[model samples]
Target: MEDNKVDSKKKRLNIVSAIIYIPMFLGMIQFFFDENYRNDGLGWLLLLTFWVIRNIDQAIRDWWDKKQKSVLFDLLLAAVVLVFLIIRGMEYFSS
Candidate 1:
């Protein structure tokens, strides 16, 4: 039914939002408690994964929506990509 299709689309959008928001929120918490956690690598890894998720979501949106080429979307995608790249560079240098 048409309703089913609409529900499916909403579900997909919710999933994409969660993928970007959840880990980032958790990572922000873990970052603030670095001393207690005592593992900077783990925190960084979580944050990096968060960035990757956002980037992937942005890519999906770009492909699915014709108007996804907005400046805000571009900035978000670029920022996420840059964060992940920095994380990769840090991991490479650290190990």
Candidate 2:
């Protein structure tokens, strides 16, 4: 019974993650093929959602491991993505 419950919990978590990640995966695939993909509002929305989710997940893992260097790297990467998103947003609207 305990093993069954654990399996159920894992199954639920997998389903939730799939719901969250599928759209981001689609957007990334599109962006890889099309240079102009960033201009699309749907792509931006999915990317931002992905960035936020990914950073939060990394932050939690880093905290659990008490890894300062990894945390700093994650922060740096998040900042770069944030900057890219902001710059592209401005250009997207300006034009």
Candidate 3:
């Protein structure tokens, strides 16, 4: 029973992660190809906001489970993503 519960929880988390990531992936693709979308910050902002909100639970769980190593990795990943998003936003708004 305990194993079943753990398996189910993992499956649920996987589904949730997919749900959150797939749209972001699509949005990034669109932003790359669509000139109008690239010039608008709202879409990027919405995607970034949704990503953080959706992944916060997983991020916290990862931090709690692995302590310092996972925290460092998470922070690094976040910094990269944030930098990319900020750069894109700046490019969009500056033009």
Best by TM-score: 2
Question: Could you tell me every candidate's TM-score relative to the true structure?
Answer: 0.52, 0.55, 0.52
Q: Which is the better candidate, 2 or 3, if ranked by TM-score? A: 2
Tens-digit lDDT track of model 1 for 20-75 = 69767787677758676545656666666667666666666655555556635755
* Residue 83 in model 3: lDDT: 75
Please rank every candidate by TM-score, starting with the best: 2, 3, 1
Clashing pairs in 1: none
RMSD of each: 4.4, 5.0, 4.6
Candidate 1 vs. truth: CA RMSD? 4.4
lDDT of 2 by residue, 8-74 (tens): 8667766776787887788666865676754466467457658866875676557656898888788
TM-score, model 2 to reference:
0.55
Compare candidates 1 and 2 on lDDT and give the better one: 2
Clashes (backbone N, CA, C under 3 Å), per candidate, total 0, 0, 0
TM-score of 3: 0.52
**Candidate 1 lDDT trough over 10 residues, lowest sum:** 62-71
| Alpha-carbon runs more than 4 Å astray in model 2 | 1-17, 30-49
Query: Model 3: clashing residue pairs?
Result: none
Badly placed stretches (over 4 Å) of model 1 are: 1-7, 67-95
